[model samples]
Target: MTLPTITVDLLDSKAKQTQKRQLAKSLTKVLSETLGYPDKEITIIFKST
Candidate 1:
C-alpha cells in the first residue's frame, strides 16, 4: 500500500518544537484511525514560515 504524505504548514514561525511534535502525533493518530493507515508508514512533514 502506498502511504499518504501529510504536510502541515504553519504560518507562525514562533511555534515551539514540543507543540509541533504534539501536532504531528495527534495528526498521525487521527489519520491512522480514520484512514486505516499504519502509524509507522504515515509521513508527516511540518514547515514553518
Candidate 2:
C-alpha cells in the first residue's frame, strides 16, 4: 500500500508545537477528504530550522 507523506518546514519566528500539531491534523484531514485516502495512510512531517 502506498502512503502519502507531507513535509512542512517551519520558518516562522512564532512557530509553536500546538500549532504544528493542529496544522498537521488539518492538512491530514483535507488531504484525506480531497484525495479519497484514509487518515492512517497519511503522514505529516514537521521540520524547524
TM-scores for every candidate against the unseen true structure: 0.86, 0.85
1-49 in candidate 1: lDDT tens per residue?
6787899888867889998899889999999999998899989999877
lDDT of 2 by residue, 1-49 (tens): 7789999887754778898889999999999999999998899998777
Best-fitting candidate, scored by TM-score: 1
**Model 1 residue 47 distance off true place after TM-score fit, in angstroms:** 1.1
Identify the runs in model 1 with alpha carbons over 4 angstroms from their true place.
none
Q: Once model 1 is optimally superposed onto the true structure by TM-score, how far is the C-alpha of residue 6 displaced, in angstroms? A: 0.9
lDDT, candidates in the order shown: 0.89, 0.89
Query: At residue 20, what lDDT does model 1 achieve?
Result: 85
